[model samples]
Target chain A: MDFELSEEQRLLKDSVDRLIAKEYRFERRLDFLRRSEGWSRQTWQGFAEMGLLALPFAEEHGGFGSGGVETMLVMEAFGRGLVVEPYLSTVILAGGTIRHSGASGRMAETVERIIAGEHLMALAHNEKGGPRHSLEPQTRAKRSGACWTLTGSKIAVLHGATADELVVSATTDTGSALFLVPAEAEGISVSPQKGYDGVPLAEVTLEGVSVQTEFVLCEPGMGEKVLAHVIAEANAALCAEAVGIMGDVFDTTCEYLLTRTQFGVPIGSFQALQHQAADMLIELELSRSMAILAALSIDSEPPVRERNVSAAKAQIGRSGRLIGQRAIQLHGAIGITEEYKVGHSFKRLTAIDAMFGNADWHIDAIVEAGGLYTA
Target chain B: MDLNFSVEDVAFREEVRTFLASSLPDYLCAKMIKRLHLTKDETVHWQRILNARGWATPSWPVDCGGQSWSPSQRYIFQEEMALAHAPETQPFNVNMIGPILAKFGTDEQKAKFLRSTANLDIWWCQGFSEPGAGSDLASLKTSAVRDGNHYLINGQKIWTTQAQNADWMFALVRTDSSGRKQEGISFLLIDMTTHGITVRPIETIDGGHDANEVFFDDVRVPTANLIGEEGKGWTYAKHLLGNERSGIARIGLSKERLKQLRSLEHELSASGQLDERETVGLKRKLAEVEVQLRALELTQLRVVSADAHGANAGAAASILKIKGTELQQRMTELVLELAGPEGLALAVDDHTDGSGGWQNPAAQFYFTMRKVSIFGGSNEIQKNIIAKTMLGL
Candidate 1:
């Protein structure tokens, strides 16, 4: 089996890499992050123009029709550049879920807008006390003829503070279902929350928030499939992002060690310090492989998808924490300072880790599906 | 871009599996599967068998008794061997010195050493490391004073793995003390049976005697034994190190360990009432490690595959060593954890006969892997290499 990217894939990666080098400079992102929003709208539009925001959805939905591996490559580049767009929340999780659930017409129109960078959607799914991807929803949806009123709050609505609309999960009389509710709907309130990576998130309160029957994003009883797809894609993207962040983490740590000196020589010259950096490199590389595998498994049928995603999340979660913690530890006291980019990168890695499921969470998921041997 | 193996490679893998099953002695395989150190005779016995079949040096050039397999085929063979618990051919001979002589040794050196080296007639130990010169190997103080037609060697070498059983050692000695540390050094091949030579086994923390401290008190060696030109030894030694780093990741062995960890977790987590959730959680973590191990193996395949096709100096090997060792330590820790109170067993001797079951070897194995990240050029060095070489750090 070959592991090298195809020539076309390599060219695409090069193009993306060159584009990020020109446009998404770290200084620009740092400036944007320190602002109230913690993200740049222009950069978001640029990504849309690049066709990145549409890479995962179907062609019919105005996307590039690229699968998970391509998505992984782009997200990894995004992670390495520390791109602070709502690609994960708006494009991947929420928009991907709607596309996967076969939502069309106006919903399809919104998806197309997202593809064109005109509008964005955030997924408001997780509630307090609920583990990631948990199907048992605490929020309720009451059916009133052609209208449905959503009650209860959704915490951790990724990019919720910025999205024009939200695809939320709630329990109905039948089962769990996905609803497209307007972000500015009456009785709906959103308070911006700070993600560890300085990205904007929100704790959304849907007090009797209402949606029309046509706004349902998933087949009434098939929310399970939509939720599964969203969680899988979300975790896969997070894994790719961690792989990217660790790439940055390894570079930052290596540069520090090379320049930082102790006992009259660069610390990089010391075997003790050098060996630690090498260990980080190992984790980063292996994590990249797992991330690719998870991204590849995104469209696979159950069992394989569960196993691959679980494995990727678990491995990336473990390595992400190690790389993040060691990146700081090796960088010494300066690493923890807000002034250092390594610290910020470490925070982002930690957040990606705790997002979908921690190492332990995914590990359990793998076993619950079947042993790796069986899978 | 295809991820599926060619039919020939697949068939080659099956051939390796069959050969390992029928050819390797059951006892030797058992030792490997359990990560037990092979007895001297057991190692030699297996190597001879492999030599006879011309599979002893799977990656060596065919004219020198190497297998005629492609790069992917050789990788598959190595992976299958490791997974089947077949004893790894002694690295000092196959991986380190043999390749050095083949690539850089003089024609005379090749005629004298190649065949016996491949056939296991001469057991070799590396002498690059010294007490004060582990990572900064160029700083070594071991000197070889030139005389008429011979050189008198002086000073000591430490951490020489398997020197006690070695017939010869390919050593790095100071030949020109006036020049730069790296430039002044030379590679010397010394017979371990020479006069004024002393070999003392240094027991590592894992209770293995494979490592040693070797001393030379004016040991005399013919100039003919020097590899390449004087002071060019540094260049040859670097070549040797480059070869060493090529396979230091050890993916095949880690894959076997992961499988063992999974089975152990299942056996432990299923019995009686523990916090079922935590038990399940721990098992899941073990599975995750296995998954990562598989990914690492795939990366290894890519690296070794490219290496076969002449893509050397890639940063992927650095990545492999880092993640492979970490995962190894994690697997050991998980096994020990599952062993619970049984993990604290100080009875290292219990596994000597392979009766430790799963519990006995778990502790000692965990302790042994603590050195993995430190030895064979520590993981930290690998990262710096990747940074400079691959990422342009």
Candidate 2:
């Protein structure tokens, strides 16, 4: 087994690192967050120009054929920079769903547009009520001549307000299905808002929104697999991002400890604080391992892929919580201030931990499947 | 970037499993599966079988009777042994003194000791931690003074594991008194049967006599037993401890434990012992710990693979120790929890033999596992190392 990145992967990682280091400074991030749009479209186009938007699509689709490892590299850099682009919502969650579902015609051209930096999309799968993190949508779909009308509310539609089109999940008479519906389609309204971490989220209401029969991403028999695959991909990217955030928080805390002197010496010289910092580093490394493992497992068979992704999401959640808390405690007041980078890291971590499946929820899922091993 | 083992590694693993299946005695496997204590002879027997295959000391170089296995092959061998219910190669012989002697011993010392050490002809035990020198090992007062061609050893060593069964004890004795505490110390190999030496058993909370208080009253030892130069015992000890931390996770052991736990869960349902809710709760706890183990297992692979590329993330070493020991203890605790009322039975009897895993001393195993975090530099001490060395705290 090998863990070393390939030459191309390393080069890709270096470019992302350099781009983020040069442009996404802390002050620039704050300024971007303060804007009316809450993020930068210019930065989004810049990512497309860098070919990141094209990274995960297949070569047959006029895109660079890449896999989860490449996504891991990019997301990790985004985490380090605290970049607030719509890559996850647009590229992985929405565009990725269409690409992986093997949908041709309009859907395939949409993916082409996404790769060419001409389109933005968001996934509207999660909804309110029922069990937490339930993948089966409460949204309903109605049959119409040469069309389907969707009638349901999709809560927390990540980056949905700005998307050119939305990938919507709904239940039909047979089972669940997904459709690519235009954002400005009749009977669609979005309550636009920003998450606590300052990323865009919207409550998308689909009141009999009409979609042509041709826009069905998947039917009942195949939709579940595609949704699970894309969700795992998103979670893997998020896991990688969490690792990047944890690493930076850990390093920043260490720097603070070495320089933040009190009581006649650096406060870090205290055994209690030192041990906390050590614990943070341990969590960071473990989280990183889980992230890599999750990335590698994205293409495996369904059972293995789902189980590993849940395991990684849970582990990253737990580690992120511990590291974030320790970072705050170690830095004292500065760690929680709005101006400080560490607090922002903690907030992003909090959001990531809550998204898809939190640690405890994922643990419940694993046990529900009769644990990770058998006789 | 990949976790797939190569074709050669898979075959090597198969070879190891085949050897274990053919040669490992059922009686010892039974003891290992249940966490029952094994007699010293049983441990020696297993180690010899492995040694005869040239597999017992795979980490050592080929010249020292070790296999020329790559790191992954060696890892597979170690992993297979654990999965097959085989006992670990005696740490004092294989992991500790043997490597030191191979790395730094004189020609005569290597010729005399290396083979027997691997073959289990010399059952070695460490004599390091004194009553006062648990974590502060530098303060050890055990002394060796020169008497012509020999040195007289004196003072005491506590927590010498399996001392009663040990044929030899490798120790760090203070050879000079006028230097720093960490200095003036020497690594010595002493015959356990020597005169003026006494081994007093220290009964642990598990009710096992696995350790002792070894006292040296002017015990005479040849200067030839000295390893490398004098006053470098601390450096050598560090090397030995570093080796200990490499495979500290023991992922295969934890995996096997989880497998046994799952089977036991099935038995619990078949016996109509646990209610549905209780079964679900138990499974949840088991999955949490299993997930934790998987995380550590991947972390270990990351470290190992990084090492293959000549990038040593030694800082991740302490992560292994802390998480590895915690999972071990958690496993024992889970077993005890499964045992429940049956565990409280006063009779010292097992419901099943080694064939079905009923001889488990669940509470005792739980208590015994407590020593893991306390020993081998202790988790606290490991954190201190990480704090100073890795985190720059």
Candidate 3:
């Protein structure tokens, strides 16, 4: 039907675009990343004030009740800015899980804190060697008296170091369950490190981390379903983000080709390089379409949502690689330098590809789901 | 943005599907489904069938006897036709010169050609590329000097597809030799039966005679045959080439070929002819191509949607061409791969056996598909267009 954004959606896009332009400059982002907190708390508060932090939550939860398209707009803008904040981890991953799992009472209070930028949350679902789509956690959760103790490690907990609470997935006697463990819990330790794209990541060790019964976000056996819901949303967000990064990277590469002269003319005038640039654009456009498809289908039935999310992730992963590599190749030596925005965008795109299942993983998932031939 | 078709669009698709199901000839559908080459008469017969239903030229304007469907409607019609194995309407008349004539032809010219073109009463072929002007078509040396009342044509054109079957040829001739190479050209419509006009068949690698080398030696064309102004052929040719490139993506055809490949794979697996490793590899390759095809389909929808909103989709068309052709070639290759030894059979007439070991024309189809990337301006030229016009490179 219609591909045009509504007037309200256009305004949201313009506001986000303006915000990124004003505050999330490439150099400013680097400065924010270098701080002790690894990101600008002021910018986090800015997102809250701008209503982006509350965009995806229910209006009853003191939020905007915005849909996937709205979240995609903000995520894409964040991607263009290469914003070094934990929005994916804090909001879509952890906050989304809580919302989907029917978090109430204390958990709902935590969601409010997250929306207000007063607290940060990271979903610690990935274990050391679990399958990419598997949410059956290896971490153990045992209830004794009035408390449940978690005892295992979650590797690559996005923004775990800075998060105020960790939405930890653990296997219980009945099945898997989600527990909100405080970052400052007595038996928890976080080894934080800068990821490939200079974003804060941590390997969290939850050694006998005790949590009250109220901290469990959902009933037993609901963890996998909740995690699946959260992952789908995160996948959609990452796909949109990759589209943004690839788009910018493509623009930067095209600009470089037009301006950077070699021999007697702009290097872009050369047919060989021009063809490569065209391939990059093709990849970017395809990725964009896929991202839109994923975003639009994020809230569908589980099977349909998973299929679309996997399709988007697979396409984005494949196209992102081509666009990123071709972009660097077109930019020549300058593309690989840290000083250039193109390279930084390439780095972020690469990270997004590896996150939430890469192309090969998603393609395999699709093949396993009746092999794409039937569809 | 919503990707689902509207209820009306869905109803239109159903209407088309029902029409195709009941109307398409079984013999023609059999040829199409098997990728067998259809004869010129067969193609014209199918066109007549569509003409009888008043759906022959979906893309043309209503005033010119076209259905004047929306872009989405046209796309759905095309997709449904391909899926139903309906023969393609010859592009020369329907897609190429017809649109140019509709836009620029004089009232007299339109009166003479528009109805006949839509009814397939006249078969047309393009005469733009010369021996030395394939991608660089502006440098063509096909000259048509002015005589008393007609242009004295004396030049040659190469890779003129379907010329053997054409009753007329819409050509580009060098009307001026002093100005820029692109400025001196003139668009002329030449009768194929004109004296001194030679249509020599050029056998392609696929062992087919679909193209030719058309030589013009003192061929006379009435002044009335010229579509537009002299020395403006390059402009008209560019417009025609844009139309040419737009449909050359062949998304519907690729979807059909992909579906055929899957069926072949299933057939091979059911008979235990494909090993487990080969089956897995085939599935993986099919999955990859399927994903790319789906993306291309969505990209096409975006372009169509953008066009409906009055936005320029020039570069998006180029993108579709590049990906569409590549996917086409890839699917054909997979078809051949699925065919195994049967694909290697050369000079095989039909893909049928009494024992149900259907012999696919995959090898010939694959060989023919190579031209998809090369013709209608090579994929390389499409990239050049994208770089220059879209990226400003």
Candidate 4:
């Protein structure tokens, strides 16, 4: 019935907006991207100081308990700023798995370290040639007397080189399980690279890396459930981020149309471009609604939650492509340039569409999940 | 933010469902469900049923014999009615002119038209679009010059739906040839039986005489029929258009069509007539459209919730109009595609009652739905409004 944000949610949004507006300028982002780590340590600390790293963790685990809507607000602000930090990789993906599967002792301690900004984590669930968003990993975990050995490679390990530890999903005889392996663990290798959007990524290879049995993040056969949960949350965050990017790109294009003129009057006065801009607005608004729906249902039962997340992801992919492509088309030559913010937003949106699952992938998943036939 | 209805709203929905189940005659529901055109008598009977229950004018102010329901209540009523296959209460009277009169009419005008409108005693038709003024309504050349206690109206109105059955017509005519095109217009109510008035049928692509071209040659209309001040017809028309766009989404009607589509798909599969590849393609198309419709429905809820809280919903309403009408058109196309070879039979006589299984009427329905996107302010005009009001272009 009510769609208004709570007062606290509004305050969280304003604070993030203020921080991004102050520090995350386009030129500043470029400088940070060129650095050795490809992001700002100072900004990461600022996020930790702002309690964003702790927002989604339970209070019993040294954090302030928040939900998907809060994460949506922060990610939306991130989208507006085009922030290149590892919040999605380290916080939501890795940290969320730890919290969901890590019931006590050392795993909980690692979460506290994450909250305190003393440790960063990355998730290595995606393997080479694996199906999109498949939880049954090809990576194998072999058990010994008091330790486990992992042998496999993970592709597109987001923030893999920068993280202190990685939560890797590996299959065993019974089912799949998650293990917390140190980034520099013996027999582990990290090959860092830049993604299409210029954020840091790496391909992580495990050559018989050994880990203590206590490093098992969750019980056997629970990896898929935990991974699905975290991925749904990630999808919700990405949906919000896409909305933010589309909003900015749309606004920038509209402004360009008004000020950049060719034939006597502003080009925006042309009916063709005006209608295109209106279409962008429609896509953006619909994406916004879907994002809200996804965020609100993130904590529901598995069927409901997965259905909503897939729906949101599918919509975001389609709308993101539409808005991004139209934005570049409307901006003419400047839209494809590296110097312009609109092009960068387009790149990020494109990357987000490919991430988790693209539109076609989610659509198939939705149909298989019975989302279509459900009333 | 919560999206669930309040307890009272939920109960109201149940009440509406119950009322519709018991009161809406099965024959009328059958006609609507089959996409068959309802005769004027059928439409009036349904309207009177709603009127007798005091649920006819849900959007008007309470003092004007309206139910004074909240936006959510109105939305629920609409959704329930559409799902129940109940006939739409003929928006020309209940939704269009009734609100205009309630908002801007003199006390005398209100007393004369409001009750009759709610009771379906008078069937109203709109006369805004002319030959050259479809999307650009301001360019309409229809003029009404002043005579002794009357206006000598002389012009033509095209695409006036149901004019053949109309008892009265609310029209916009140029009262002065001065200043801006929008500044000289006046809104006038005319009796269909007036002298010099002609309602000639315009056969549509759907093979129905549902709309007409109304010609006025020195049609003497009393000046008392004017709703508001002279030269202010555009403003009043804008108000009515806004109301028109709000309900243009037609989510409920689309839902019913979707239900029928599912049944047809089932029938095809059952009879071994379904092509697997084509069926798969149709399923994907149906799923995509359904997903978009669901999003549109939520977007509508957002607008309704905003309206309930007294937020400006003009831009939101335009978004609904664009998406709603597009989905409606898409649904019709899907239904036609599902009919396969049978959809080519468009003649009314070719259709046997309850025997053709949607194919006989599917093509006709598809042709009729093309008008939805064109009317109620063309989707292109809606985009222009959104650009100006929402995008600040």
Candidate 5:
């Protein structure tokens, strides 16, 4: 019923917004983007100190049990700032998955480290042959005595190069399972990959990597649920991040239009470009709504959760592409260059779009599940 | 800060829902729910039901037969109507001209028009856009020359929707030729029965005569018919436009369409194996549209709520106008896509009850909606408003 955020939520949003606005400037990100690692450790430690890393975990687990909406607020601010931390990987993907699926002692320890900003973790789920969902994971895990050894490659592991722990999705004799292993475990090597957004990704090769029995985050054969939850969170987070980027796109474009004069007047005064800007505004607003709805359904029981997650992902995916493409189109050749921040935001939007489930993928899922109308 | 409805709002919501269920006729509700073309009688019947309950003009002031509910209450009431498939009060009378007259009408003007408009005693139409003055409305060339307590009007208006069915019209006409285009105009209320006034129906691509080209050849009108001062018509026109833009958004209608789309998707999915690309793509797009619609609705609520609280964001009204129309057009596009070949079929004898026959209306509707973004100040004008008024462009 009510759509307004609570005073507390608004305050939280303002705090996050102000923090990112002040400290996480694009110049710093540009500097970091040129480095081999996409982000600086000190900036991440500052995020930890600000409790950004701990917002999504339960209070009892030394974190805030903030739901998806709050997480969206934080991520949106991060995205607007273009903060180069692996918050999406460490906090949202691996850390969020473990926290939601009845955290084990080892998993809880990892969550604690992630929240403290002492360590990072990335979800190593997508195989080279599989799409983002890849529910029936290709990574194989065999029971050798009491311990399990996983052998396979996880492609495009987001922030894989920086993480200390890797949450690997594998299919065993019992079905799908989520295993948490050390990033530097024996027989595990990562080939660093640079995403279009300049974020560090890695194609991780696991050759008989040993994982303790207790490291299984979810019950055997119950990993599909864990994977679903992770996908939902990641998808929702991506939507939120895109909204932030889109906001910047609008802002940057608006400023450019106002300052750039044509026909002896600011182009912003021209109705044609003005109309286009209005449409972009509409798109941005629409994407924000999708992000909010997706975040709202993050904790809901399946099929409903799955549907909403797909809906959000799909909408955001389309919005990201539309806005990114439009931003470039509106900005002209200067936008395609490296100097303009709009280009960078455009790239980031496209990359977030490709992650999780793309718009088409989610739409298909939503249609299959009959989620188009009911939710 | 709390998003939860207050206890009074919850009670008011239930009251509205109950009234809509018990009071609005089933046939009319069915027409709205099924997206069937509603007869004038069906629309009038539901409007009467709402008027009888004194819930007809929630947006009007108490003195104007409005209940003067809080913004949140109005929001809840309007939302329930859409959710329950109850017919809406005709916007031409209730929203467009009524509010304009209430705000700027002379005492004589109010006595002559206000009551009839609220009760639907007189069907009303707008005459603003001329063939030349579309988005540049101030450039309207329709002229009203003063002559001994009356004005002789001569001009042509295009895209006048529902003019053929209307009994009265509120028009923008030039009153002075020497001043700036905006300053010379005036708002005039003209009876449809006046001599020298003609309405020629313009059949839209939708195959319906929803619009008309109205011509005036020296039509005479009493000076008393003018709302506000002669030169102030431009101001009143601007005021009327704000209302027009808001009404055009029609967030409630979008919600209804979205609901229909969801159900249709389910039926389609159940018939057989869905084409993975088509089915999923449609579902996700639906969700995406729903999200935008939701945000627009919330923005609308905030605006209405502020007005109810005696504050206003009138300057940002264009924001809703642009988004609302775009979302509506997008929804129609999706509906067309879902309807597939059936959507493309023209309304023919097969589908109509011999009244209109069977051709699917989706394609026609989609075509009609293409004008939504181009109308109501062209959304381009809206951004200008936002830039100057909201962002200080």
Candidate 6:
């Protein structure tokens, strides 16, 4: 029944907050974006040093045995600072797939590399017109004695251009499978995309790319199960991140209302604006509750956890738009600039909503399961 | 009451279409039709061809080499040029500085720069927006100090479009500090090759390099370069903005893009990219923008006709600025929607598979067109202008 963070979880949150204060200042975030990789390697290394990179992995895998709640703590802080590192792709999603997949030799070594910030991986599942964001990926994987070959196109893989490895999902003869393919493997092509929020995104294509048998993270039967769990974890992380963004946007807009003056008085004095600001606050609080729900329910039974995360993601998508736009409308011209914080927050919210699935898509998922309560 | 183009205006439209088909280069036409970027050389080359035919500066005064065309004729000319996929006439030369010189410049200044500007022999860029003075341009700190026969200019200007390729820059510099912030500004022209001047290209959000930040470290300019009276720069700046809003609506460009989007939608739908449900949603959104544009066109025509009757079109100009940009932006957003997630891939030329090349620029144009709402008196400012000037609030 207790909602208070554990002492260790409180320490984790504090560490993330400190790192953000030190590294993710708005100007420094812009600096990272200007770099070739569109993220800060030094900050990623710092995460490795702080043991934040290994937060969600088992201690046996050279990690801290943390779970979704710990990841939530890190993501919320990262969101407030608009951190552009691909932590969601590299750590929460791809790293989770590996940690839960029970790999023995090379795969465990890959997890170690990831914990050390020496390797970055992304899950490539979204296809152009694939069914339901590729829970059952259509990418064809064929085995030939000692090796497997994959062929498909992934439309939007976050940080796809910078990933050293990609956890690609493919369909085999019996069922779907997950393979850890080197990003620079033969017949692999990546075209870089400009993310709406300055996150590195790309269109990745594979044409008969050969993968060794040892690189298989999950066999045919386990692939779809692992992928669904990975996506649910990602959805939970994104919701927490969105809650942080909405809270920041609401706080800044209130500050702006107090400080920004027009017509010889602070604009916050007007009752019309006061009501709008209050509505934004309401949306923010509701989204926060949903994010917390997702974080706490991450390890529950399958249907409960999946339904909760989808509901949280949908709430974020709806609420983020209201809060982001309210911030912009209240701040006027300065809010939409590239240099400003509020506009970038809005962009990130937009990018979050677009990823995995948008609000309507998830709402449809909930309804297709005969609504949230039924699930 | 008559909304149709006159018989002569229709003939002029046909004449413009014929001339564009004959004169517009094939490569440039392809670039314009495909919405691809045109090189600075290609732009200047096209302007020179227009200049050779005495059609480069149609809106200028007849005494200053203008065609003395009616307002309808000019509209037809611009619309026809857009429809034919010709490269746009460089606005800095014709719409901006050329008309200013005709109105207020000294006879010698006109003789020195007018013909050269018209022929694109001297590419011009605006240097009015300083880093500290975007929407509130009167707060600019760029200094122009008189030293005998020369004025030493020193300060920075940002968002200066085409500064790298420009041969000259017309700028607003602070010449005095004793009076109101808006009163002490002076319009001055500085040659781009002047010593102690540096142009740094600023990459915009859309990954375009059309804007720059120019730094002046004690650059010297002859007093002859000053436009109009000293401390009257703000007045000229306002006048320049009025002219700037002339094509801000860019109706013809939007119409062409909408036409292109229609075809793209059909192709994607035929390829099973868009299902019936998605197609219905997209079609409805497209129809909404088309409806808004049609209404804007009527209002624009009313403004044109009202101008013919000597009524001021200031209120309608603000309306056009707001609604026109909204429709343009809405269309780009729909293209991004049609592109779905794949639109984020902007590297169109390199290894495009499973989708048309049109998908790449969907995100590019959506991110890039955001400037239309922010720049040249943001849509918010336009709303305030509408409220204060039109509504008497």
Q: Pick the candidate with the highest DockQ.
A: 2
Candidate 6 deviant stretches above 4 angstroms: A1-375, B244-246, B348-356, B391-393
Please, what are the lDDT tens digits per residue for candidate 2 over residues A1-375? Answer: 888899999999999999999989999999999988789988888898899999988787767889889999999999999989899998889977887778876566777889877898999998888655666788888887888989988888888898889999888888878898988999999889898898988999989899888888887556677888898999999999999899888989998998999998998899999889888988888888889989999999888888888899999999999999999999999988999999999999999989988999889878877676544
Each candidate structure's TM-score, on Cα atoms with residue i matched to residue i, is 0.86, 0.97, 0.97, 0.98, 0.89, 0.52
Cα lDDT tens digits for candidate 3, B112-176: 99989998999999998889998899999989889988999998999999999999999999999
Model 3 alpha-carbon drift over 4 Å, by segment: A373-375, B243-248, B350-360, B391-393
- The window of 10 residues in a row where model 3 chain B has the poorest summed lDDT is B349-358
Instruction: Please give the C-alpha DockQ score of model 2.
Output: 0.78
Show how many residue pairs clash in every candidate, following the order shown. Answer: 10, 2, 0, 2, 11, 0
Colliding pairs, model 3:
none
Provide the TM-score, chain A, model 4. Answer: 0.98
Interface RMSD of each: 3.2, 1.2, 1.5, 1.7, 3.7, 23.5
Total colliding residue pairs, candidate 4: 2
Clashing pairs in 1: A274-B380, A274-B381, A275-B379, A275-B380, A275-B381, A276-B380, A278-B379, A278-B380, A278-B383, A363-B284
State residue B118's C-alpha deviation in candidate 5, in Å: 0.9
Candidate 4 — which pairs collide? Answer: A1-B2, A1-B3
Fnat for model 2?
0.79
Error of 3 at A333 (Å): 2.4
DockQ of each: 0.38, 0.78, 0.74, 0.63, 0.28, 0.01
5 against 6, candidate with superior lDDT: 6
| Model 1: CAPRI class | acceptable
Error of 4 at B140 (Å): 1.8
Writing each residue's lDDT as its tens digit, candidate 1 over B167-202 gives: 999999999989788999998999999999999989
Ranking by lDDT: 4, 2, 3, 6, 1, 5
Write down the RMSD of candidate 2 (Cα, Å).
Answer: 1.8
Query: Which should have the higher DockQ, number 1 or number 4?
Result: 4
Q: How close is candidate 4 to the true structure, as a TM-score?
A: 0.98
